[model samples]
Target: MNELNGYDIEDLEVGMTASFSKTITEADIILFAGASGDNNAIHINEDFARTTPFGGRIAHGFLTASTISAAIANRLPGPGTIYIAQEMRFVGPVRPGDTVTARVTVKQLTRERSRAVLLTICSVGDKVVVEGEATVRTTSRARREATV
Candidate 1:
């Protein structure tokens, strides 16, 4: 959505937050499984997954986390931001048809390095599915330059 404009490194402030929501789908799981080479049956085979504690096939954990990345790249810091590192903890499972919301809040910023540390989270309704921290190297004035 063009509603969000990328913020320069200097413009970011602690407590600034952004979010995006997506509905998990079977195709999403299948595509992510192929792209990530994670052929784990728990994510692809419902019959096999039904035997597990999760009760049915679950989406790849990284797929859920990628929603958080999408929020960062498209919403908060917006474009021209490069992911430096991320630490994630998968606390719950996401199933097809579930609506997941990804949120990122700026926790710290280093102006000299143009880096920001953010608290990232993904949830299905009130239950947290994933939580973590991400560090990004952001560009100052890159959005303006790209438009020109």
Candidate 2:
């Protein structure tokens, strides 16, 4: 399915789902640390990370969180999805070589507006790395049909 795009006030609905998955790699952690300037030992220094509570290198929280964007963009609400807000919590660490997956489900839609409430989660193996809720907007069918 195509990503959800610019929605209208009349298009929102509840119980929608979207998702995407990726394997975390050492390179990904390195690049994220360098780009985001979050050079925390746990994320970039293996030896230093070993001494930390997690006992190994872990990916940045935001890096794992960012996977939600890809999930919403590639699946459920495809091309034109508009992100309004996201509330996320990192429940566990994402180490290199772990495969992470994110899934978003629509929980509610405001009838007066084209906005939907989405519940989402990102997981690695059997552990949940991040979970959250997001508000998004998409164009209504009437708007698209008219344009077409």
Candidate 3:
């Protein structure tokens, strides 16, 4: 859960990276389905999933997307990261037991406003499960130093 902690705006920098890994579980899929109200057969009913093109159950897209939060909190903007925007593409299915890793790379910095543009990626093994971009604003490192 340490990976789920975030930091303030003043403590971020461009080129920072944060990565987190977690193993998918059936319970996670079920819980996500209930919490997100996305009870698509592929994520809930195994029998119904058997008829789908994938022929098996898969995790909800947002469940996979949620993994990015951990990376951002623990790595990118550790304590006070604020989410301004996110764009995600679901590229692959996430099955139970697959260990997925989510990573965020700070791609651009807008120093005047204390904002960062980041590229976020989630993968299982060699296959990418999701990719997207996110915007975060954090306390300026200079501001924190000045206060101290």
Candidate 4:
């Protein structure tokens, strides 16, 4: 890890991997709804959600997908990473009490290691709930040293 508690551009390798996990909770859903203004009934109302194909209340796709953010921001390229873009597909529902494990793998790196493409995946046990890709920029030790 670099002084920033993250990977410096030069520290990254194309196959590096890391993960983070969190269990969805009622409070998490409510808080997400309040914070994001995404109060869709399927995510916040059990009865309304039951009528949908999901069968019961489900966490917001973005809320559940937040695990992927956590994985990227706290692991792998870590703290100094700046996301450039992301693409995601929500394939399954995550309910309250489901533990979501998000994994990130380094897919590609620029020659200078200043940019990276990562594969992101989140699962509840064996069921994949989210799959995606992300591009990010990282701090460069050479650049930082040059400024000093």
TM-scores of all candidate predictions against the true structure: 0.91, 0.85, 0.87, 0.96
Candidate number with the higher lDDT (1 or 3): 1
Rank order (by lDDT, best first): 4, 1, 3, 2
Local accuracy of candidate 2 as per-residue lDDT tens digits, 26-113: 8898899889999888888889999998999898989998888887666645557778999998899888998889988878886545
lDDT of 1 by residue, 17-84 (tens): 99999999989999999999999999999899999999999999999989998999998888878999
Which candidate number maximizes lDDT? 4
Candidate 1 residue 32 C-alpha distance from true site, Å: 1.0
lDDT (10s digit) by residue, model 4, range 98-146: 9999999999999474999999999999999999999999878898899
**Alpha carbon deviation, residue 12, candidate 3 (Å):** 4.5
User: Which has the better TM-score: candidate 1, or candidate 3?
Assistant: 1
lDDT by residue (62-103, candidate 3, tens digit) is: 888888987876677765677899999999998888888998
Which runs in model 2 stand beyond 4 Å of their true positions? 1-13, 144-148
Q: How close is candidate 4 to the true structure, as a TM-score?
A: 0.96
Model 4 regions lying over 4 Å from their true place: 3-5
When summed lDDT is taken over every stretch of 10 residues in candidate 3, the lowest stretch is 1-10
RMSD of each: 2.9, 2.7, 3.2, 1.1
What Cα-based lDDT does every candidate model obtain? 0.90, 0.78, 0.82, 0.91
The deviation in Å at residue 38 for candidate 4 is 0.8
